[model samples]
Target: MRKDIHDYDLSRHNTFGIHATCRRYIEFSDEADLIGILASLTEADHPLFVVGGGSNILLTADYPGTVLHSAIRGIEPMPYPTSADDILVRVGSGEVWDDFVATAVSHGWYGAENLSFIPGEIGASAVQNIGAYGVEAKDIIYKVEAVEIATGSCITIPAANIGYAYRYSRFKDEWRGRYVVTHVTYRLHRRFTPHTAYGNIAAELQRLGIATPTAAQLRDVIISIRRDKLPDPAVEGNAGSFFMNPIISRAQYESLLATWPVMPHYDVDADRVKIPAGWLIEQCGWKGKSLGKAGVHSRQALVLVNRGGATGADIIHLSDTIRADVRTRFDIDIHPEVNIL
Candidate 1:
């Protein structure tokens, strides 16, 4: 357990690079350390917020509560039963997500290669149901290990019990701030089942003159595609996608399609259709536009970048303006994927 700091700066902790401070910040390096910290804070009055990787949150302002971070790190491949064709790997919550994906690809582990370069840590993956291309975290997650915040008891829950959906999980809902995730177990296949149907992975690979893409090739292509579309947080402060693609009824999509003939959409189900939020923002003429130091990314309108010295409010204002315009112009409501703190 690290000594707590008072008024700790969080500019570097979050990907948006917001200059917010917390009243108290504590970091635990391992499960034992985390248990100790939780036990110590049980009688304390300040509210607790646990964060990993800091990639999915937008700090709106200085926090008045205690902030918790887990630094526990490791990835261990567990033995698989002879009857099963899959392998189970247990990972610490603090391990970098991309690094784990890279390791899996190198060792011929499938399923996660399509999720190649998505940011955040292993712990946040299940919480956010982080997905890319055609794959989501929920698909491979076998179980999650966490410590209850209230009682400091460790519990292992099956992935099915987490109530996962597109970009959502129970961790973000009823269980929010109630547990500190310690480890995640993923079931991956020994065979590489390439998924290039979503986005431009297939076309991009073809453009690169590759007729058949291996697991590593697919991973590399996905990383390249993301790099071209999304700004690096190190260079320009931004989350990958600021808005969740709005899902509407099929009737509503048909109504909009009649007005905008070139609109792109996908069927979420028999009655629901999903439209790209980026295309909607572009249609509203907000792409590459800026308000103060916040701007829509030139390459991808779904990303809102910090044009240096941008505060949380600046980004929020820009998002609000875009949301209102989208609703007024298309009668669709686009919500944010980034968690606003």
Candidate 2:
């Protein structure tokens, strides 16, 4: 089925909770419905924006074009060789991402446990390549099934063709607004291999006195860690991790390290390193600081929160201020991870 509304209120559609609306909002629950809706679209719906779960966007103003949301839902296991150690499962794009991860762990499926509580839907997971702990969606994704917005033809794109990178995919670049994802197939392990070294997972596990943790145990640890750090969107109107950690040259890292002495970094390659944007933001004194109605999240500097009734422009202003500070102080440029419109 499909639901089409004109001049739709989008405050609930976006996680930022901005008071905004679009010229049109079209939601479809199945492929046929999506195809039919697309076929009937007029020139009024020329420009389109696709959103999933609304956890990764910041709406700045009333949109002048159509906004498409997927309501398609399902999860089905695909048959594979009985002796194979890994299993393949097909999931609807509209399925809640964390719910899928929970189900996977419940059924003894591995590889997704480390990504336990990240927000957004399965479709957006592929689009954003959402990651947590040490696992990215691309690590388990096998193929992506989508509909070409222009041709209205179904396309099954192999994961190898997605061009996955840190917090990005082709769906966000050259393929932006070109396709609507319908389903994603993931290759999951039947055997559990724990990824506990990244972040504080190992420490959390050790604190719980679990040397060899189960999938469920690991998932719980990740959930607990995230809950302690990030705010709930329902209670606080904000998108998580407002900025992407900037990657810089090794020489640049050394120069900054000499000045700060306590700078933390991760190796991206021999010549490049990824610096934590949150650390930089904190050093600039933005953490827990408010600019107008927008503020940096008190616990995690990477997040920007709606202190109350903040407009999209307010959030942008806060982000801009922080970006300028970081640039001036560290000479490292940070970019937003959230999609802003």
Candidate 3:
């Protein structure tokens, strides 16, 4: 572990290129260093925040406390063949998500292929419950190993207990930073089971002339489609998706459906349905809308981008405007998917 602060620039660290200074910055190599650093901070003095890949966060203010960069990296492949056709493999949390998908496809391991090109480390994936196309991280996640910050102890939770949903987790909603994820174990497959059920996935597959696609080919398609749609955080300082697809009750959905026949929605569970926030944003004329450097991406209305040099407050205000507009137009509230600091 090393404690460095003098030359650190947060603009490059965060996906949203906002320039904010941290009071203190520390990097740890393993769990031992993590414990030491946490132990060093006093209750009121230490506002210990975990930063994993810095993809799904917006730095809205100058941090007054310490920032711990999660660098715990190692992938342990545990293969289990549950018959002649099934194969499962577990991955590490600190590993790069896209790299993990690439390796899985190379080895013919097949669960995370659909989530290719998604940014951030594998550790942060569970918190955001990252999903796209016709697949989600929760679908293949078997278990997650994490260390509780309060008691300085480690624990493992099953996929069922993680409270998996469309871009949500117990870690994000209820337990925020109660635990720092150490490793993630996913149960992948061997056979080629292409999940091209999503709206454009099938069309893209047909265009590529691939009837029976391999795991690698699926990763390629997902990466290509995402590159075309979502702006790369490296180039355009922005998180992939700003707001979550709002989930509403069946009654509310039915009412909306009755009013606007073309309103898009997906059944989340038996009682609730998820409505696309993008539809609401596009309806309100937010697509490509600009206010100084802070504006909503032209291609994707759900994504709020930093065009040049925008303040955190500028972005926050834009978000508020979009939220207010969506509510006024659709009578549905929109919640940010990215964590606001």
The estimated TM-scores of all candidates read: 0.97, 0.98, 0.93
For each of the candidates, the C-alpha root-mean-square deviation to the true structure, in angstroms, is 1.3, 1.2, 2.1
Quick one: ranking by lDDT, best first?
Answer: 2, 1, 3
Supply the global lDDT for candidate 1: 0.90
* Model 3 superposed RMSD (Cα): 2.1
lDDT tens digits, residue span 1-341, model 2 = 47789999998888888899999999999888888888989997868999898999999889999999999889898755564888998999999999999999998778999998888899999999998776889999999999999989999999999999999899999999899999999999889999998888988888889999999998888899999999988888889889998999999999887799999888889999988899999999998999989999999999999988999999999999999999999988999999999
Best by lDDT: 2
Which ranking of candidates, highest TM-score first? 2, 1, 3
The alpha-carbon deviation from the true structure for residue 89 of candidate 2, after best TM-score superposition, in angstroms, is: 1.1
Error of 3 at 38 (Å): 2.1
TM-score of 1: 0.97
- Model 1, 1-341: lDDT tens digits are 48589899988789988899998899888888888888887435378888888888999989888898878799898866663668988999989999999998898778999898898999999899998887899999999999998888999999999999999999999999899999999999887778998988989998999888899999999999999999999999998899988899999988988899899887889999889999999999999999999999999999999999999999999999999999999999999999998
Off by over 4 Å in 2: 81-83
Clashing pairs in 1: none
- Candidate 2 lands at a TM-score of 0.98
Q: Give the higher-TM-score candidate: 2 or 3.
A: 2
Error of 3 at 312 (Å): 1.2
lDDT scores of the candidates, listed in order = 0.90, 0.91, 0.82
